[model samples]
Target: MEINGVEIEDNFAEAFGIQVSRILITAATKKLALVAATEATGYGTSVIGCPAEAGIDGYVPPQDTPDGRPGYIIMICNMNKGKLDHELLERVGMCILTAATTAVFDWMDEPDEKLKTGQKLKFFGDGYEQTLDVEGRKIHSIPLMSGDFLVEAELGIKAGVAGGNFFILAENQPAGLLAADAAVDAIEAIPGAITPFPGGIVASGSKVGSNKYKFLGASTNEKMCVTLKDEVEGCEIPENVNGVYEIVIDGVNEEAVKAAMKAGIEAAVKISGIIQISAGNFGGNLGKYQIKLHELF
Candidate 1:
């Protein structure tokens, strides 16, 4: 299929089922909200490498949010519920709750979901913990040196898809980055999705194994590396195409990832110097969720 003259591959993007937590961070303004969200999602590009995979789901308008300030919704995912809870407590405690003028809430709609955010973070209060219930959500207020930190009692956990991605083959590094930026911008408006990379693009993609190191689980994908094109097997660098970048996304489910990938690929392939749109997969050995790109579009 062609989107604005760029070819869309028939390949599928593989995804895995993992536990996810939705966190709503409210701050005094949109700027602070963005900062808290960015910090919360930082270094959470992939669960394969990072402790968790997370990203800003989207922004909530002041009228729609509980705190009446601009808010951000971020989703954190892990291989299991225990890992998800640990990472959520660590990241949200250090990143969001510590940020100035910020308060956290359970973004999950289900009331029965376990919420350990406040339960874990209330220790920062050093025995001065106070709890309040607002609009059916429990908020724990912990007194701090700076002020009181407020967080919800429980966070919602659900099954989510991880490792949704697409590769951008471009004429140069700048072109690839520009195309990736456009793709990120286009999909930022999509709900329940996020690209958790440094600037939302991965320049160095990894392979499943290493030739020299027996202990290494993953090393660089040498064939896809432009600098080592001459030595690696299956190197397919087209003339004038010197750079490749990958856009990885995490979402609430397979359909969400599939929809976001379609929009992302469409936006990316429109840019000049972009040659091909592809994806990363484990040859159906890893993930339980499979998204067919052509069928999605």
Candidate 2:
């Protein structure tokens, strides 16, 4: 299939089921919201390298925000609920609460589900923590150096899809980057989805294990590395394709991942130097669900 002069290949992007948490970081203004969001999502791209995989879900308008300020929605995925709770407390307490004019809120729609976001972070108040119920939602106000930082008692958690990715093969680095940028722009507009890659692009993909190191869990994908194509064993890279970039996405569910992937693939395929779109998988052994690109398009 062709979309805007770009070809959609018949391939699948495999994904796995993991625990996810959606968080809202609100501030007095949009600038502060962006700042807190950037920091909260910083150093979080892949669980392979980072402890967690997180990204900006999207921008929340003032009307939709809890504190009536511009806000950003972030989703964090982990292997288990305990891991999610631990990372959320650490990142929010150290990063979001410390940021200026920022307050954390739960993005969950339900009230009863417990994830203990504010409940755990309240310990940072050193016995000065206070709680308030606003609009039927419980929020904890912890005093800080600047002022009180409000956060919800519990966050939402659900089984979601992770490792949703697509590879961009191009004639050169510039073309590959351009295609990846366009894809990210498209995916960012889709709700409940996030591309956690660095600048929404991954230049160095990894394989499952290392050839020499018995203890290493993962290593670089030699087959996709252009520089080492000639020297490395089992490198299947094509000629004239000097660069490759991967767009990895995480979403609340399969539908969300499918929607974002469709948009991203469509936008990416339109670039001039993009050659083919492929996906990353461990021979269908790892993830619970597999998304077929051809079926999505």
Candidate 3:
């Protein structure tokens, strides 16, 4: 199939099941809220190395939030339950709690499980923690030098899909980067999904394992590398295509992820110099969900 003159390869993106928690970070001002959200999601790009895969879903208006303050929605995902619990504790306690005039709330209305993150962090209040009823929801208020930091008693965790991705093949680096940026911008409008990589673009896409190093869990996807097109056997890079960028998405469910991929691909193909669009898979070895590119249409 072709879109806007760009060929769409007959392939699928393999995704895996993961647990996710959506949270709202609100603060006295929009700047503070964004700062806290960014800090909380920091160093969370890929689960292969980072403790979690996380990113800002979008910003919320003051009137729409629980605390009547400007805030940002963020989603954090992990494959392990213990690790996700610990990550939420550390991120909420150290990142959001330390930020000025910040408050955290569970954004999920219905979750598969609940983690007592705020219940655990409440001890830092040093016996001064007070439980308050806000808008029919229980909240924990912990005193700080800046003021009181409020958090929900428990955070809701739900099953989500991860590793939904697509490759943008372009004639050059500038074209590829521009297409990737456009795709990320389009995905940002989608609800219940997030592109977790830095700026929502993966410059160094990896495969399951290294070709030379056995110890590495993942290494450069040599077949897709433009620089290695001549040297790597079975190179997927098309002739005249010198740049490629991958957009990795994690969503609340399969539907959300599929919507993101569709939106991203549609926006990317509109950009000039795009050669083709393709997806990565490992012969059904990567994960259970095989999202076919053609089926998206």
**How big is the positional error of residue 191 in model 3, measured in Å on the Cα after superposition?**
1.0
How displaced is residue 149 in candidate 2, in Å?
A: 0.5
- Among these predictions, the greatest TM-score belongs to 3
lDDT of 1 at 18: 75
**How many residue pairs clash (N, CA or C atoms closer than 3 angstroms) in each of the candidate models, in the order given?**
2, 0, 0
Those runs of model 3 whose alpha carbons end farther than 4 Å from true positions after fitting are none
Model 3, 1-297: lDDT tens digits are 999999999999999999999999999999999999999999999999999999999999999999899999999999998899999999999999999999999998579989999999999999999999989878999999989999999999999999999999999999999999999999999989999999999998999988799999999999999989889889989999999999999999999999999999999999999999999889899799999999999
TM-score of each: 0.93, 0.94, 0.99
Candidate 1, residues 1-297: lDDT per residue as tens digits? 777776667777777787778888998889998999999988787766789888888889999887688999998888888888899989988898779888898886443357577788988888889998877778898887778778987788887788888888888998899999999988787787788887778877877778789788888877778887777778856666788999988877777788788888888988998877777787898788778778877
Please provide, for model 2 over 1-297, each residue's C-alpha lDDT reduced to its tens digit, 9 standing for 90 to 100: 756655566677789987888888999989998899888888888888688898999999999876778999998888778888888988898889999988888785432246877888888899999999867879998998899999988888888889888888888999999999999999999988899888888877887889889888899888888898889777766776887899988988888999998899888888898877888888898787889888885
The segments of candidate 2 whose C-alpha lies over 4 angstroms from its true place after superposition are 109-112, 231-234
Q: Please give the lDDT score at residue 170 for candidate 3.
A: 99
How much is 67 displaced in model 3, in angstroms? 1.0
Residue 267 in model 3: lDDT: 96
Which lDDT value does model 3 have at 94?
Answer: 95
